[model samples]
Target: MGGLLLNCDIGESYGAWTMGLDAEVMPYIDCANIACGFHAGDPSVMRKTVALAVAHDVTIGAHPAYPDLVGFGRRSMVCSAQEIQDLLHYQIGALDGVCRAQGAKVSYVKPHGALYNDMMANPAQLRAVVEAIARYNPQMPLMLLAMRDNAAAQAIADEFGVTLWFEAFADRAYDALGRLVSRNLPGAVHHDPETIISQALTLSRGEALIASDGSELLLAAQTLCVHGDNASSIAAVQRIRQALGKTSAS
Candidate 1:
């Protein structure tokens, strides 16, 4: 196993409101998934975020969610394949415009919130997303959750000629099947820095962490996600980066 890329969801703030500490968190992440207005970002925020990411020499990715601003794109929307494809194109195009304006390029696409979860289990939704990405830029990679035993999503990505990066969460707990434990459940999130650091180490070492059911679920991931909403997340990322650096040096 080699060092894994660390990514974070950012630029989530809306007008007259603040969200994640983007500046503080940027130095620790390899990739920055900037929200494309659908979930929680506005035009001004998106531009500023892209510039900041460029300044920090981080890879920029598009984080597109459903067109549900009020629900923060966390509520499932009933959408047909065509509808999903259209939404994906619209959102990716929005981010591409911002990235172009900022003298940067959107290197990948990561569906945000509910749309992301829906695509995990629904082949139709996955195809829609893959098709949208292929239509926009066939070379761009698709970011997806790390699955324990299933290869459906990966298969879809392969069929579409799109590279896939399996993403593991730093703050979220996992079930035995390697799926994220429902947020509605207790102990779904780990906010403690030490705990997060330990989990990250396990992931980086290609070891399986104990899931909620006490079963070991292996995940070979290329990227790890640190939530921007957590206050201590920056510190946690720093700790994980330092740990990985030391391991690599040794």
Candidate 2:
């Protein structure tokens, strides 16, 4: 009953290539951010993932990314605000269609990879993304990385009249500013299940996290993200769920 929503990026496998043990991870998560076609998943994958989520009774969310399948949507590209907005709408609509066919509804929209990072700091891009979500389904909430005491994103969401879910990364390192450490750097990821569990517990308890510089930073989040691509990520999520259960009961 505590206010913590566990979410995972899923449906990333493309064609014959596969990524993430999504089937193993789904049961442990409350929300599944299924990849739209732009990022990594195809139509077939989307349909299957939607069905899996429906069967598991997990909340579904659209995982839209820049049209860079070659980069796995991790690489940023030069795109006009209009182009970005259009692509986002298209991606969300596609997922919505699939979810409807499966008798499931997308409950939220979360930008993926480079688009996610870029929109967090860029007002123009953020506006574009917000606008896109508003156009498609204003009631559908947006899930984005939490910014410490920053009201810009919140204000935009308010203007759009859409709920926002501030998200925190449980398996990633953070800087003193409470921003995620660049993936380009070493030690950006927590591969140890113990460390991941501890971090998730700390965040769940509304405690501060120690940044790389040994400074305490506060993160206010409604949802915690566990990357599906990491090896041993399923075990990490299971540990987190167990820890949350223990904390809740204590």
Candidate 3:
């Protein structure tokens, strides 16, 4: 099997308001990063999402985020390492509880939104996340962004005896350092379906991407993240999955 697994951020619907085409994209994804009620999703949404993932046989991952329901967990907040760990445990446990009800467990963890970006940029924050997962369940892997040089992150994960699944974004732009460009920046996100699919294929093939700074950047990623927030994005994900199937077979 190919080393690359397809994952998507899903189960983000909050209360009566809904988000994402979770049902439409579940079949194509290998991992479902379900929102764990902190950023988005409530008990009902979490239960429904976990059931859907179980039905589709997709690996369930806890999508932990800062407690920012109003901000959708996209706004960064000042938090200490202990606080970060607390947040992770709270969110993961909530999702795991929902998953257990459906006879499934949270197989992994992928921090959501600002917390994810914060961990990538701050080693202390990353360590807190890793430590949280390790303390909860050492077997569960922690998914973080794939960088140009992943040695530091790997070292930290190794220290905690936690497995790391370096993830790449096919629909997002990267900087020279292999960090994702800010959404506020121009051309930070790839909008075209063809561009998104091509990027997915490139990363799957272990090829280099042209960074936003016009530099060659390569990311060693074990999973590729695709967004399912809209119809056009879902269409791109479908094409991406089909294209990746050929790459995997080859």
lDDT of each: 0.87, 0.87, 0.91
The list of candidate 3 runs beyond 4 A from truth reads: 246-250
Candidate 2 matches the true fold with a TM-score of 0.95
Per-residue lDDT value at 194 in model 2: 84
lDDT of 1 by residue, 208-238 (tens): 8899989888898989998656567776787
Best-first order by TM-score: 3, 1, 2
State residue 50's C-alpha deviation in candidate 2, in Å: 0.5
Over 140-231, each residue of candidate 3 has an lDDT whose tens digit, in order, gives 99999999999999999999999999999999999999999999999999898889999999999999999998999999898999988888
Q: Tell me, by lDDT, which candidate is best.
A: 3
Residues 9-120 of candidate 2: C-alpha lDDT, one tens digit per residue: 9999989989888878877888899999887999999999998888778899999999999999999988899999899889988999999998888999999999999998
| lDDT, model 2, position 109 | 94
